[model samples]
Target: MLDIKVLGPGCANCIKLESLVKEVVSEKNLQANIEKITDREKFLDYGIMVTPGLIVNGKVLAMVKIPTKSTLEHWLEKESSI
Candidate 1:
């Protein structure tokens, strides 16, 4: 299964990112482990210097800006195969 982590501090962008990830997972019908990391300290562990970080399978996929649906699907599809 693909492991996805969204790191943020309960901000609007964070919430939207989390929701978008969930939607993509559901739409793609893939089994994934989705986690929301709200603790600021966790960001440091993930080497994230910005809110709304997207980590897929322990690799940082994005930070700050939200990824497009196609971009997200591509990441998810690639990671889920591994």
Candidate 2:
């Protein structure tokens, strides 16, 4: 299973990113543990200096912006396969 983290404060972008991640995971029928990290201090541990960051399997996938759905799907698919 993939371990996914959505890092950000409780902002619009952060919520959107989290929702999108959940959607993709469901659509793909992927087994993953998706977490939303809202603590500012925790963000630093991921080296995230911006809101709306995405981490998959402990690797940073996006920072500061929400990725396209297709891109998100692709990344999740690739990671889950490993």
Candidate 3:
């Protein structure tokens, strides 16, 4: 299963990214472990100084911006196979 994490402090962009990720996962029926990370210390642990970070399979994918659907799908597809 794909292990994904959305790192944020409950900002608007963070919420939007989280929602978008959830939507894509549901629509694709992909097996994934998605988590919402709101702790600032944890973000530092992940080397994320920006809110709305997307982490996939233990690797940070995006920081500070909401990813597009296609970008998300591509990542999901890649990670699901692992």
* Alpha-carbon local distance difference test for all models: 0.94, 0.95, 0.92
List model 1 lDDT by residue over 12-51, tens digit each.
9999999999999999999999999999987999999998
TM-scores of the models, in the order given: 0.97, 0.98, 0.96
Q: Hey, what RMSD does candidate 1 come out at? A: 0.6
lDDT by residue (tens digit), candidate 3, 1-82: 8888999999999999999999999999998888999999999999899888999988989999788999999989988887
Question: Sorted by lDDT, highest first, which candidate order results?
Answer: 2, 1, 3
TM-score of candidate 1 versus the correct structure, residues matched by position: 0.97
Measured with C-alpha atoms, the lDDT of residue 60 in candidate 3 is 89
- Winner by TM-score: 2
TM-score of 2: 0.98
Q: What stretches of model 3 exceed 4 Å from their correct place?
A: none
Off by over 4 Å in 2: none
- What's model 1's overall lDDT? 0.94
Ten-residue region with minimum lDDT total, candidate 2: 42-51
Candidate 1's C-alpha runs over 4 A off are none
Better of 1 and 3 by lDDT: 1
